[model samples]
Each structure stands twice: as structure tokens, then as C-alpha cells.
Target: MIEIVRTSDLVLLGFLQSLLENANIPFFVADLHMSALEGMIGAFPRRVLVPADHVTQARRLIDEAGLKAELLS
Candidate 1:
């Protein structure tokens, strides 16, 4: 998997997940369970990842959603 975006914004994370789901793109939210360890302080940002083959499409989708700034270069 390739990391596409890392964010502490739960709302944006949910929106991105939904966007990927609607487009039939498989994704995984890494470190999603870390909040328990970090006391839910948003200290550990979640990572959005996709298969190597899906990186381009996933990035394009995120970019179109006006989240280009969130994408990893």
C-alpha cells in the first residue's frame, strides 16, 4: 500500500473514506486505532492508503475534492 494522505481531521477522513467508497476504490485507514493510545487528542494523525495500482486514481479523487493539499507528494 502507498500512503496518500495523513490527517487529524476526523470529518475530512470520513469524507475521504466515503469518496473512495463511492468510487469503488479500496482503501485502508492506518493507525485508526491509535487514538486509544494517544488519549484521543488527535496527536496521532491517521494515514490513508491505497494499493499501489490505485494511487493515481485515489489521488485524483482526493484532488478533485479540493483536498490536494492533504495529499502526500
Candidate 2:
């Protein structure tokens, strides 16, 4: 899988998740459980990952949703 977006904003995460789900793109949110270790201080941002084959499509979808800035280079 390839990391597409990494963020500490839950709202943005939810929006990205919804965007991927609605588009039928498979994804995984990495480091989500780190919140417990970090005491919810947002020290570790969660990562949005998709299969390497889907990276391009996922990126395009996020970009089209006006979240291009949220994407990881």
C-alpha cells in the first residue's frame, strides 16, 4: 500500500474516508491506534493508505475533492 494522506484532523480524515468509500477505493488508515499511546494529543498523525495500484486514482479523487493540499507528495 502507498500512503496518500497523513493528518491530525479527524474531520478531514472522515471526509477523506467518505470520499474513498464513495468512490469504491480500498484504503487503510494507519497509526490510528497511536492516539492511545499519545494520549490523544495528536502527536502522531493518521495515514491514509491505498494499494499501490490505486494510488493514482485515490490521489486524483482527493485532488478533485479540493483536498490536494492534504495529499502527501
Candidate 3:
């Protein structure tokens, strides 16, 4: 898997998830429950990951959606 977006925003995560789903791109969010362990202080930001085979297209879609800045370098 390739990490795409890493953020502490739950709303943004939900939006991104919907965006990827609508695009038919399979994805996983890592560290989703870490925030709870960290007392919801945003210390362990969640990560959005896509399969290695879908990385390029996923990145393109995210970029086209004006979320390029959210993607990992």
C-alpha cells in the first residue's frame, strides 16, 4: 500500500473516503483508532492508503479534486 493523505481531520477523512469510493478506488485508513488512544488530541493522525497498483491513478484523482496538498510527498 502507498500512503496518500495523512491528516488529523475526521471530516476531511470522511470526505476523502467518499471521494475515493465514488471513484471506485479501494483504500484503507491507517491509525484510525489511534486518536482515541491519544485522547483525541490529533497526535496520531490517520493515513489514507491505496494499493500499490492504484497509487498513480489515486494520486491523480486526489490532485484533480484539489487535494494535492493533502497527499504525502
TM-scores for the candidates: 0.97, 0.96, 0.93
lDDT of 1 at 25: 97
Better of 1 and 3 by TM-score: 1
Best by lDDT: 1
Residues forming the 10-long window of minimal summed lDDT in candidate 1: 61-70
- Candidate 3 accuracy as lDDT: 0.92
The residue-by-residue lDDT of candidate 1 on 1-73, one tens digit each, is: 9999999999999999999999999999999999999999999999999999999999999999999999999
RMSD each, Å: 0.5, 0.6, 0.8
* Residue-by-residue lDDT tens digits, candidate 2, 1-73: 9999999998999999999999999999999899999999999999999999999999999999988999999
The per-candidate count of clashes, in order, stands at 0, 0, 0
Candidate 3 per-residue lDDT over residues 36-60, each given as its tens digit: 6899899888999999999999999
Off by over 4 Å in 3: none
| Cα lDDT over the full model 2 | 0.95
Structure candidate 2, residue pairs in collision: none
| CA lDDT, candidate 1, residue 23 | 98
- Candidate 3 is scored at a TM of 0.93
